[model samples]
Target: MKKSILLFTTMFCLSLVVFAQQNKEQDESSDTVKTIEKLKYKQQPGLALAASKIFFSDKRYSISGFGEFNFIPVQNNVNPEMGDLELYYSSLYRYATFFGYRLTDKLIWNSEFQIEFLHYKTEESHYEIVIEAFFDYLFKDYLKARVGFYPLTIGYVNNNDEPVMFYSVNRSEVERLIIPSTWIEFGTMFYGNLSPSWSYALGFSQGLNSQKYISGTWIRQGREIRFDLPKSISINPQLNYTGVKNLTLSTSGYYGNSGQGEFIEISGEPVEVKGKINLTSAYAKYDWKNFRFVTVGTYGQLGDTEKLFELTKDENGENGQVLGKEVYGYLMEVGVDILPYLRKGRPIHEKQNFLFDTHEMKLSLFSRFERLNTHNKIEQSLEGLPRVESDMEIWTVGLNFNSRENIVFKANYQHRLNKFNGDQFPRKNIVETGIGFIF
Candidate 1:
């Protein structure tokens, strides 16, 4: 742990020197004023990097990567008898490399190769592979088309998973458990701007695999080319409005049939099941001065659960066949950039106070609260089925220190507010720290 901290500090200091040098060079250049003005309204480099692959760009091709390292130095259990203070390295969260080519002014090709290392409680570790390859064509300002494997446009976190884009050391529990961050699938989509402040996206994609859909964690069903092929199809649509200054409001939904023409033998007879899934969500974000706030709510439902249960009963056994008919979750967060108060000076340029700007150093203190219920409702007919009480509430307080728009250091304390299924579960409070960078 000490070694890690030392390494992080050294790199952080070096990054500051490099940033200072870059800024100094910019100041010496003739375009200093223009550059500063552009930075004032520009989004973080992290977002720009992600979008550059599919959107308009002058360069013929480019390469970029992002990575994050996390550690948990302290974990206090509520029950003394349960365990002592625990400490360990959390995981090498994400290592992703991207390749993008601009075939023409209106055509682009992009691909991403990513690997994530996850550690389990039993001192075991494994790696997961993620890939996103897609092609996009610009038809006009109001219409465009994209096809191939891409991240699902379900919520804010999935598309914006870059470490520098969020204030918390870890993503929200609701997004992880309910919305399923990093969810990706093969699909074709059409998106366009409706007006200066409004936009929309619609897509059709391969649907979930019911065999993998377990209990309240519906997102686990995302089939990423693991099976021979998926028979189900999903339709998703989203709308966004940014008409209000410093505010963004958006909503998205997903509907799909998960069964994919699969059949199972029940009571010595062949039975076909069509498990349908539906999800809807709405969210809003607002920025006022140095303060930022966001709220999101989502509801999900699965159809033919009773049949799905019977079909999987033999293969998964009785204990593993619990699939929720309904699920829901919500999250709320607020943050303040305290660095402006600590530094005694005016911004470098006008429009520098825009919430999305990331050219300057930022120090933020944030808090988030969330609730998730994987099995909010179940079919009454599925009697004798053991239901796992997958309901949870969580609170997190954190600090984010960004040396530059693409490099960040984070620390946070998280508390689990609700116990799972009574005294059998242990409640743990965790202290987490991490460093993230992109280039």
Candidate 2:
């Protein structure tokens, strides 16, 4: 752990040094701002970089930010349904200032330090500050390697941040609360193009226990049970293929295991419980210039051994036994763009004109569905819930307005249903509106 931390520090310092050198070079090359070179951003990551390259010839210093506010008003009966509502937002929200800089042509650093209320609550608190800062090496024109605290590159939505692109003002509620966006952890990764129309990325990241809760105390062979902390690792791989000029398809998968060690007291003696979790997932997506479709599915299981047991003085003593359970889930989404009908405002293939005419606006209608099942004892016990299965289905249909790749406006109506305990949750619905931008 010490060595890893040191290495990260050293790399960060080295990148700073390189950035200074590049700044000096830029100063010597030109005194005043000039039109940006066309291919300067061909090797860059996204629109932010490309836009910054346009404003600041020096890649060493770049500035960018985005802000958004969402409102959800519920109308109907007095008792608010408990299911599917946790995913919806009721008031003010924002993901602002996010900034990044290219230390050198081969290395870049980015951060998504955030400030927002938890579910639009009145109280405020610090969320995660350090988003992602890593050293990337461009091995070839299309291949790259990165290491540091970065979001896992699993699905299309997982890889995209709020500012650059998103199908909705907020991500699918299923993915937002469950999968966690801007979810970063220490890890290493490799990304490159497989062919002209296909690209791929592979990486490994620290894993966490999937159990939702904890019950009685457990010890592992005389030692107190310490919940799993970076004990397991995750494997993520993705493949993207461009089927046509405007259509793209992608598939990705993730597999991991979580490890926890514990110790318990049995009739005056110390006992132990070591739990292991296995998780796996696969997803596919299709993007056509203005329309999109996606499907994702995942499965996980937890296993552990009883190892020891105690009984009353006159009661029969029990031997150690093993306990385990399996859980599974899946999600799907489909949407279409309405901006295609908004009349093409400009020709992208043509030369640059005024700022407003340089890009076009697009709108889309989308829907998403999700489900989860925990049918075994191991799962129920681990989550501190009964052995009852829980599943949720949400339907969202909305319109999104995106203009010049910088500003976005959205409005959507959502209806969600929960299926559990043989009682179908009442259909809950809400209307949401939002605005966001990137620089």
Give the local distance difference test score of model 1: 0.68
Q: Write the per-residue lDDT of candidate 2 for residues 65-131, one digit (tens) a residue.
A: 4455566664344222232233333554554443556677777665555455423232212222334
Compose the digit string of candidate 1's lDDT tens values, residues 1-439.
3443354456445534433443442444445431111122133211335434334334577555566777664223333222111112244456676677888888888888876665434344555688888888878868988888877777777767878767787777677667877678788888888999998889899887786665545546445654356676799898989999999898998899888787877788888878888888888989999999999899988888887876555444664455668888999999998988876576544332222234567899999998888777778876355543447787899999876666778999888755455332223567889888654
List candidate 1 stretches off by more than 4 Å: 1-56, 73-89, 226-229, 310-318, 345-359, 381-388, 422-427
Q: List the residue pairs that clash in candidate 1.
A: none
Candidate 2 structure, TM-score to reference: 0.66
- Runs of candidate 2 with Cα error greater than 4 angstroms are 1-58, 74-89, 120-130, 141-143, 209-230, 243-247, 260-277, 302-329, 340-359, 372-390, 422-427
lDDT of each: 0.68, 0.50
Taking all chains together, the TM-score of candidate 1 against the true structure is 0.81
In candidate 1, what residue range of length 10 has the lowest lDDT sum?
A: 80-89
TM per candidate? 0.81, 0.66
